[model samples]
Target: MFTIPSPTIVNTSSRPLSETTIVRRKTRPVRVGHVTIGGGHPVVVQSMINEDTLDVEGSVAAIIRLHKIGCEIVRVTVPSLAHAKALSEIKQKLVETYLAVPLAADVHHNGMKIALEVAKYVEKVRINPGLYVFEKPKPNRTEYTHAEFDDIGEKIRETLEPLVVSLRDQGKAMRIGVNHGSLAERMLFTYGDTPEGMVESALEFIRICESLDFRNLVISLKASRVPVMLTAYRLMVQRMNELGMDYPLHLGVTEAGDGEYGRIKSTAGIGTLLADGIGDTIRVSLTEAPEKEIPVCYSILQALGLRKTMVEYVACPSCGRTLFNLEEVLHKVREATKHLTGLDIAVMGCIVNGPGEMADADYGYVGKQPGYISLYRGKEEIKKVPESQGVEELINLIKADDRWVDP
Candidate 1:
């Protein structure tokens, strides 16, 4: 049988066997307007507005709405030159009417001219490497020769140079955003429809930007499938490490459909990398309103202990030993203290395991008897109150500690 070690016999000078903290990867900071990504900054939350860029009023209002509710960076699609020009008006209006929110422009399909124009207005320009210098795929071609591959590569460089130079001179950032569904034909021919293709496509663009001495860059390799998305980002990080590159990564699972499954799918992929210390900025791409994506992003960050924007509640599942209605009482307790940010409050159904299980909480509401509930402050039993008065007493306890804030 395994034996437990005695505390008196344990070495006092030795470090703890393990730590719960996550050690983040080292990466240089890339600024998106006033917000920073990587370089030990807290993970950033982002969402894209679905409004058309040409509708400047609607787009500006949407950007302001998203920004007011914790979206640090807002993205809009620019499909043509007119839409790109519309951003200039949208930006000016935001400054005049609301705040100068950080903006990113999404450009695709041979968008060199459009990107250059939009780059003048936005803080960052995001380009899909596969579509930026689009080439209609030759249906009969099976493979690419070295000469043909290099020839198209040179074309990409020429087309991308002007926009790179514009963003560089303007002191702005660019995202080498690659999607699995739209990888370049040459990359598809060489690397097949694999994660390798996604990484190579992003790298080709990163190299072009680097060759121009422009490094204000962020990289993303997003795939709709969770496994493919996970693999692509891991491979990208591995390749970047091998090449001594420290560009920040933007993480997401593309086309994660609406409702519970979408949130779960995104969290499964994005949260896995974050736990491994990989991602810098994240967007939960849900099919719901852009506002819904913000909460999901913050929830993921809060659950991981990386950011705390709301109260953390700890409740025990009701059992036969439970002294009260756990579900109902938990709801009441939460409603009362929901606005107490940065505080951990526990709601235990019984005293048998309550004090021990909720030992780490800042404040605890635990059942002590059939008609009474005990209030605790970090494992110390402060008082026992009638069940009807438990939540109010807990609030009183917080007020006594001077931690209660009026909601």
Candidate 2:
């Protein structure tokens, strides 16, 4: 319900129904298995399997379930040497079953061994720049001098060099995923624990990879705070542009808790960036089951008109003028025609709010009286029917017009 003005947006739609159209940022493509991200490819939807990585069967099943529901990329945590070794089995099982989904190893805290061991088995490996090779910051910390800072950077490079070389040799990719909650001590000292610090943490690792002449890299700047999340990603894009580094970006709001708040926060943060054309891949980090995250991802993409995966419903908030059971009727309509995608259906409460109100809707259903319903096709009044028969009439209308498809 809150609205703010943005002047940089260009008129994207010929009709201008929404605010400015989002022009996607152009970046070099990074291959993660069979999926192509960036370089004008469609934004990829990804999710992390919550099962333990060592539990090969559980993890493999999770990935299969995710793939069935449209997840394009998947990540599994590799916290131990065993977990790192398990990635080979997981990838082997996926291959054996003819599932081509890419596996990414998420490694943190002195992950050199795991990273090196897992790199060749999976399509990509994700290292948290904050914890990949740095000591965790404490409440009481010693400030390092300039010389010490350089020494630390060199130490990090030494730690990561082997893994980077392995990834390069294997033709695999790396995601320099930096979370706002876990900023490195060096960054905290130099830039403070802020969005700037988050960007710097990622850049440090990215610079290391580039120094090695490794270009198969992706980047992410994630935070639970919407403003911080958005700010960090935007800064990353600007900095990448300035440095002429076009590595693909992965967007998310970390620790976005379960249910409606989680969905809203994820959407606000991810959607804003997607609207600005910044993200190359996205993962909605809900505390709920990971499979539940897929539909929400597709819904956000569909709402922005960036992708179409299902039917779009545009119903009004019913007022006292509402003549019938608006929610009941709308639900029935959705249930009946959920398979007809890329079409906008509006279920309005009254005529005064129908035709013009749902102007963007491809089809409209409006209450004409206490027991009567009116229908329209893109603002043209199509017919009226009894309220009791309204749901069936709407389906019949859609079928009559060749819009119905069996699910």
Candidate 3:
């Protein structure tokens, strides 16, 4: 027999409510190989390969692993001409094996030559606007005069013209990625080390790309600080709307160190922009390996109802009213159901917040008395079982409902 706690049932739905829906910003799509950014496409998840670009075999192995785990785009550094040339071989090997994963080259310093060389090999070239045109800020110089700034812009155009032409002709894309720590001196003098500075830094290159009639561009405004990252992206969106430029945005929080701290920082920055519908592609930067970053990306996207990959687990913090070994039971429950994708499973320690807390979850396991557990398929109690029997019963319930998927 089923035991229903008074007021246990709460409103639960499989889909998010209408009022909380995120309306993605409208922008023209930019194609990076086979993946599409903006234009109402799902936000793409991408990661950079830290392996040496010269290690074609190592890089290919890493890419294959990342591809299996659902990384849509992959980027590698092309700091030298050799690395740039290596990209062609990498692409060739990937094609020979039918990987077809879109590759991007992150170029700086000697970007123009590397970009030009890698343009035909990779789908996109990412250049940091701050480092592309100007040398690192020297201690002697404070700011650039108006004419000096114009000359700098002109020089940038001169350097970029050939590569821009090559990329345009080759049907390639560019990412003017601007970072908080690397703003050019002129921008710093004008706007200080703020979001305005980062936006201006990127806008300068964006205007350059536009003048050359190259529209296949994506932009990023990244900072290690979550607040700064969020502010920069918000400011960039407003500026893009003002300029009537709907270029796709790449979102990330740079140097977000590893483990829980990294995940929290990345989520706060990238997740906020995603929630506001302001990002086209996202990378969850962690100190860990690149392949480890993919699941976190999917997790953030899934929580926002933007994308789905694995099961969503909701477990309440244990409290005085708890009636079971929640940690052990929860682990057991997850181990059994981790492969279930797109389902919300709630493991509540006690009735206090069980039903209400699990209102958004599709299935719920709530602790009742010392050894008892109540199972719910969306609020209504389906059965009562002992603590020892709960996990198996949950699986049985799922199978009975025909919601079981082989792991």
* Models, CA RMSD each: 7.9, 4.9, 9.5
| TM-score (C-alpha) between model 2 and the true structure | 0.91
lDDT of 3 by residue, 1-407 (tens): 12222222222122255658877878889999999998999999999989999999988888888888899999899889999998888998999996789998899884787788889899999999888876556688756688977887789889988888888888889999999999877777777788888888888888878888999999999999998888788878778777999998999999999999999999988887787777899999999999889999999999999997888899988888889888988999999999888889999999989999999888999998888999999989999999889999999999998999888
Report lDDT per candidate. Answer: 0.91, 0.86, 0.87
> What TM-score do all the candidates reach, one by one?
0.95, 0.91, 0.91
Q: Which window of ten consecutive residues has the lowest lDDT sum in model 1?
A: 6-15
* C-alpha lDDT of residue 35 in model 2: 94
| Clashes per candidate, residues 3 or more apart or on different chains | 0, 0, 0
Tell me the TM-score of model 3: 0.91
Q: Against the true structure, whose TM-score is highest? A: 1
Where does candidate 2 stray beyond 4 Å? Answer: 1-19, 136-141
Q: Where is model 1 more than 4 Å wrong at Cα?
A: 1-17
Off by over 4 Å in 3: 1-18, 136-139
Candidate 2 lDDT by residue in tens digits, 127-172: 9988888675566656767887898889999999999898888888
